[model samples]
Target chain A: AQSVSQHNHHVILSEAASLELGCNYSYGGTVNLFWYVQYPGQHLQLLLKYFSGDPLVKGIKGFEAEFIKSKFSFNLRKPSVQWSDTAEYFCAVNARLLNNYGQNFVFGPGTRLSVLP
Target chain B: DTAVSQTPKYLVTQMGNDKSIKCEQNLGHDTMYWYKQDSKKFLKIMFSYNNKELIINETVPNRFSPKSPDKAHLNLHINSLELGDSAVYFCASSIPLEGRSGNTIYFGEGSWLTVV
Candidate 1:
């Protein structure tokens, strides 16, 4: 089974601090990667996704993620995070089944980011 | 209008009770999903329906049932709810990502269910 692991469970940073959240997946084949964020009392929103060409994908809110196939990692980063960046971040992997019938999704436990203003 | 919406934004029920959460998507997506988010903020896919057909059914208990009247609607019905069932249930819809093999999901505001 495919599983996603996030390196940090909780991260606290002051405003304007550089941020990087490490994500790794245990899958051997072609897979789609995504980063989703959930603000307080809100639904999960798509931060970014990597499907094909670009290893470095830019998403909304000045966030970006780099997909490193060699290490099975897709890490989310921001040059400078603001207080509004506080949220729970989830790393997800979507892989096709061997039977070619359907796809499976594996989500990491999520990392909570608290950006102090 | 909201692209995806779930009814009963907040639900409080006692154990052994039955409840249902309704969902609808106006985005004309062919796939819909039910995801459970625990208190710790762990999100897990419980069920997924594509074009009104059951496609992905995770290791969820039989007490939880999902119904899709159409491609744009997916509803979840929970029976004999237990304390452990208290969590946030999210309804999502997705359309195939063009030129790619994957799909991009859109989530609803979610229904908070508290089983007492």
Candidate 2:
């Protein structure tokens, strides 16, 4: 079975500090990666996704993630964090297949990020 | 407008009772899914419906049943609910047809269920 692992359970960072959250998966086949964020009392929203393109994928809110197949990792990063960036981040993966329903996503235990001003 | 919506934002019921969580997506998406977020905030897929047809049913209990009257609606019905069923239920939608672009899932504000 495929599984996703998020190394950090909680992270506290001051405003304008650099941010990086580790994510790794246990799949050997082709995969589609995603990063989703959930703010307090808000629904989960897609932050970025990596399909079959450049290894480095940029997403909304000045966030970006790099897909390293060799490491089985897709780590989320932000050059500078803001207080508004305080949220829970989840890393997910879906196997690529022609049948849409055949693709099931595996989510990692979220990392709660607190950006202090 | 909310692309995906789940009714009864909060549900409180006793064990052994029956209840339903209604989900609807106005995005005309072909695929709809039901996911459960436990108290620990770990989200898991329970069921998925594509074009009103059951496609992915995870290792869910038999007491939990999902119904899809149309492509835009997928409702979950639980019979003899247990205390373990207390969690947030989220409804999501995505395009599943042929030639569909990247599968981008849109989730709605979850329905928090508390079974006492």
Candidate 3:
């Protein structure tokens, strides 16, 4: 089974600070990557996604993720984050195959980000 | 309009009680998923149904059953619930990545289940 790992369990930063959350997947194939954010008491929202285009993908809220095939990592970054960016971030991966059920989708534990004002 | 919605957003029951969570998606997605987020905040896939057919059933206990009446609805029923079953359960749907449509999964607000 494929799994995703987010190294940072909890991250604390002040407003205007840069942000980078690491995400790594153990799958070696044509895969789709995604970054989802969940605000307090809200549903998960798509931050960005990487299918088969440029290695770097830009998402809403000035966030971006770079898919590094060599490291099996797709890390999310923001040059300067705001207090509203405080939320729980999740990293997910899914193989391209549709029939294989097991490889359908996988989500990481999640990283709780607290952006202080 | 919510893309993915689940009913009984909050469920509180005692041990050995049986309960169910209902989900619906208006996006006309063929694939629906049931995921449980434990207290540790670890989201784990419990079941996946594609076009009303069971496609992925993880190593979850048989006590948990997922039924898809149609492509847009997938309901999860739990029998003889345990204290460990107290967690937030989420319903999600997405177009298959192999499909021509963009495959972006959307999640519900989450159904909080508290089993005492």
Better of 1 and 3 by DockQ: 1
Candidate 3 per-residue lDDT over residues A1-117, each given as its tens digit: 588999999999999999999999988667889999988877788999998779999999999999999999999999999999999999999775444543377999999999999
Q: Which is the better candidate, 1 or 2, if ranked by lDDT?
A: 1
lDDT of 2 at B61: 96
The DockQ of predicted model 1 stands at 0.62
Clashing residue pairs for model 3: none
- For residue A60, model 1's alpha carbon misses the true position, in angstroms, by 1.2
lDDT of 1 by residue, B6-96 (tens): 9999999999999999999999998888999999999999998878888889899999999999999999999999999999999998874
Best by TM-score: 1
Native contact fraction (fnat) of model 3: 0.61
Interface RMSD of 1: 2.0
lDDT tens string, model 2, A24-106? Answer: 99986777789999998777999999878699999999999999999999999999999999999999987643343455677
DockQ for each model:
0.62, 0.55, 0.58
lDDT of 3 by residue, B1-116 (tens): 98899989999999999999999999998889999988877889899888998888889989999999999999999999999999999999987666322478889889999998
Angstrom error at residue A106, model 3: 0.6
* RMSD over all Cα atoms, model 2: 2.0
Task: Judge candidate 3 at residue B19 and give its lDDT.
Answer: 97
Tens digit of lDDT per residue, candidate 2, span B1-116? 98999998999999999999999999989888999998778989999887888888889999999999999999999999999999999999887633324678889899999999
User: Candidate 1 — which residues are off by over 4 angstroms?
Assistant: B96-99
